[model samples]
Target chain A: MSRPAGKSKLVRGAQGDWEVVIGMEIHAQVTSKAKLFSGASTEFGGAPNSQVSLVDAAMPGMLPVINAHCVAQAVRTGLGLKAKVNKKSVFDRKNYFYPDLPQGYQISQYQAPVVGEGKVLVDLPDGEIEVGIERLHLEQDAGKSLHEQHPTMSLVDLNRAGVALMEIVSKPDLRSAEEAKAYVTKLRTILRYLGTSDADMEKGNLRADVNVSVRKPGAPLNTRCEIKNVNSIRFIGQAIESEARRQIAILEDGGKIEQETRLFDPAKGETRSMRTKEEAHDYRYFPDPDLLPLELDDAFIASIAASLPELPDEKKARFVKEYGLSAYDAGVLVAERETADYFEQAAKGRDAKAAANFVINELFGRLNKAGIGIERSPVAAEQVGTILALVAEGTISGKIAKDLFEIVWEEGGDPRAIVEGRGLRQVTDTGALEQVIDEIVAKNPDKTAQAKAKPAVLGWFVGQVMRATAGKANPQVVNELLKKKLGV
Target chain B: MSVDAATVRRIAHLARIAVEEGEVEKLKGELNAILGFVEQLKEVNVEGVEPMTSVTPMQLKMRADKVTDGGDAAAVLANAPQTEEGFFLVPKVVE
Candidate 1:
């Protein structure tokens, strides 16, 4: 596999040769029924303000009750990334004033987070890549600012306010746009597989703040620029590429890249400076007066770890070794948690290779074309299993099995029943096939002479017999009978 | 633990506050008071304690290597402060 070219350029600076150091801070929403500190539904697409609770809306007298499920999900997410699960964590008040933030300060893990020191294995075309996960911290999300609906005044919707978010931070490890995109993709996959967070970038469930810098090869790191609130994976790559190139051009033109927070304009395909980056003290982060320090036992951490499901990498490896699938196929199947589950369920008690082909090539292709998910697929696991069973039992040819799948997809009937009802079962009776071949050979003596001269032309006779049998004749048996009849 | 006036002004500016010069001293005093309370964390013996990242310990979740719907440019830019012909508009700073 080839590595993607570096987006930033090496240049001579006032401080001498410089190198780029990149890190990322990703905010992923926790998958749970309630908000971080309230019993309100965390479901998206609710009526504005309907999801907000007293705690979520920052009511003065209402106290926050931490959702245990959200915490469990955060811990599960840490374990999935192979991070250290800290038994004790603290929620601190990050003081800031914004119309979108109903609470004067955000309740976020500051000095301490629940998980630490993990690594994500990103699969690059060159080889397997490992991106260091610095920490996975939890915090409540702020509300949204609706600026367009009202021209003079901005309206705030607290629906997302107080919802739990896990800010997974990474070390300065990624080198190119492709790697950055792969890292986010892999992180989302792990989060989904753990069932901790939905990791939906579009729903505002997951977003990445990309940190990029430029320098000379193998030199000390240079001042970095952070692109904020990039919500899509493609934009993440585009931002990194354009930001790095912009920095390179600036340096090449004898200018310095400022340490600032920037925003990616996907339309313009460039990153614009937002503001100078602020340090921690700027937020006036301090322990919250309302919440107490969270304390847990070692056994509690161990229990959360024990409950984690098989992650993507582990499932991918198992798919390859157990099911005889290619590494690429395994990667595709295990990319989504639900798709992996669907494949495993479909492959049960069937030829693994055939089942994998059907799932990846036929089923996934159809789902992609129809813009549906594997979970919402019209074809069920048992239905696919039945189709495979028919092919296995020699009741239908592989070509016919595809047609059967379409029938099952559209008409919604049993696979075996459809094959039987349509009389599409393969004609395995060698005697009947021989009789047909004998008739064809006698009827077309000239063709039989030509076939004897060119034995490869026997395929024409096989096709004729298949057409004669309405494509119900087994292809292998037809070929065999044609060969024996023509004596070639 | 008293925060200096200069440090307070810098912090305020970094945080995007348009604070008046005379108000810096009062803000400094209040920040010092807050910092003094947070200093209590230094007293706890956390020598062997790992830094926590989340409230409940968990791992990162994984998603599939497939593309979701992100091609709609008009829908994405619809919420921007100012936009022109499918592009976000910002004040021109460069000549």
Candidate 2:
């Protein structure tokens, strides 16, 4: 993928002008039933220490047993990103000392990562941008260190320890805050569609370590600062903008930007330096002596590729070309795999454009307001199909169909039955509609005279007639009758 | 593959290590030996070979996104080197 052309001078320091260089390392938790090395349930919300297994807790003499399912998920995720999946990979010990990290070092991928060289297409307001994927490596997450519960003593939760994490590194291709946010969003959508990870930022299931630096346009990249573990998309954008401006300001003055690791203060919307940046050797990374190199064959890689589902980009393109959906509509439907599936099933054997409109505007709008996912929608795909069927057969007008949708959402009944039971069926009888229009025109003679003189005033008469019949009157019949009665 | 003394010192500084000047020569030799071993990897025809990131080619396990109680603040702060008002306290840098 081509990188965005650099424009606008971002130079901040006194000696020379500069441009901002940005890259990201995102760690996403894999969606699996058990921990990476143990059969301990990967269920969240258990009491502290309840979810910990012997291996997870790093009990004496407990050897790590690699979970096969976690491996498959990693392969699936790599394939979903269109990355090269290495048949064989190795685990190394990334030595570091922190309260949350047990065993004094984390077992992670180093020199040999399982996946390599992929691209993610980020949809911006202007157009779609493809960001290059440097690599996606697997590692185990450390436990949480709780510092807020007590005034004097700190506690640790081992629940997250030994959980699998895929550290996806991206090339320094992003230029603006919007692009960075879009990149993460698109990556999350892809991961979710692959069924490999939940990519939930709230639960720390997905987090980003942003690398930011500022330099003159076309100048050598500045020493970048690493912002660690930003968990929200909004914060990711804020951090990039604030940090870039901060660098620009510092350079505009006489000071130099320091290379360090920083943390984003979401409340303040600023990035504060945590510590000086550490090089690869700082962690003293070495091949883990306890574990052996993993080796696989072509057959394994082929099987993983075969099991791969349609990715987000592929589905979006299909929706555009095959279903005749607008880019925006296609994007909305394909953002979530389940939502896309719901739309496809609802649109089956129906007017594709109409189905797209109903699914995107009406159904999705209602679902968003109700705070429900497509999977948990009260209006099932089959029910939507039924509703669209009714509309297609002209049994109910579009206006009445919307009313029936509300009834279906609340009562969870058949669309046809709801329309019949509530007597909300469209009044297609031209005579009845004409009679209602005549009565409305007779009651408002002055308005009818004005409408006859000005043809645009026909909507007023149509509204009055529809209101009299409680919106059940067929709109086409009412319009025709109103035009005839007014004699424009 | 041999790392020079200056390169060793630079790496140490990058890693935030307060290495004594006298030890730079010794560390340089050690680093050189390590890099020599790593250089052997280049000899193998890995033109089409992909880099490995993890053993067993597995993903890290994840949990459902719902937020649960991260547990009591007091319990978490117990391990802090210093604390005040239920938050970790580093040396105050500003007034």
RMSD of each candidate relative to the true structure: 8.5, 6.5
Worst 10 residues of 2 chain A by lDDT: A1-10
Give the TM-scores of the predictions, in the order they appear.
0.80, 0.82
Q: Candidate 2 at residue B53, lDDT?
A: 51
Write candidate 2's Cα lDDT for B1-95 as tens digits.
Answer: 67788888877764558999899888988888888888986788888775565567665332343222233445544555765554445433220
lDDT of 1 at A380: 98
True contacts kept of each: 0.01, 0.01
Question: What is the C-alpha lDDT profile of model 2 across A277-307, one tens digit per residue?
Answer: 4444367788776666666578888998998
Real interface contacts reproduced by model 2, as a fraction = 0.01
For every model shown, the clashing-pair count is 40, 35
Tens-digit lDDT track of model 1 for A1-488: 12222434233455454444568899999887777777767778765565666666665687776777787788888888999988767889898867657577899998888888899999876678778899998899997766565445555556678778999999898877778889999999998888878899889889999999877776567778889999999999899888877887788788887778888998999988775444533577887756666666778778987888888999999999999998888998999988888888888999988998999999988899989988889999889999999999889988899889998988888999899889999998999988888888889999989987898789889888988887788998888778878888
C-alpha RMSD over true interface residues, each candidate:
13.0, 9.1
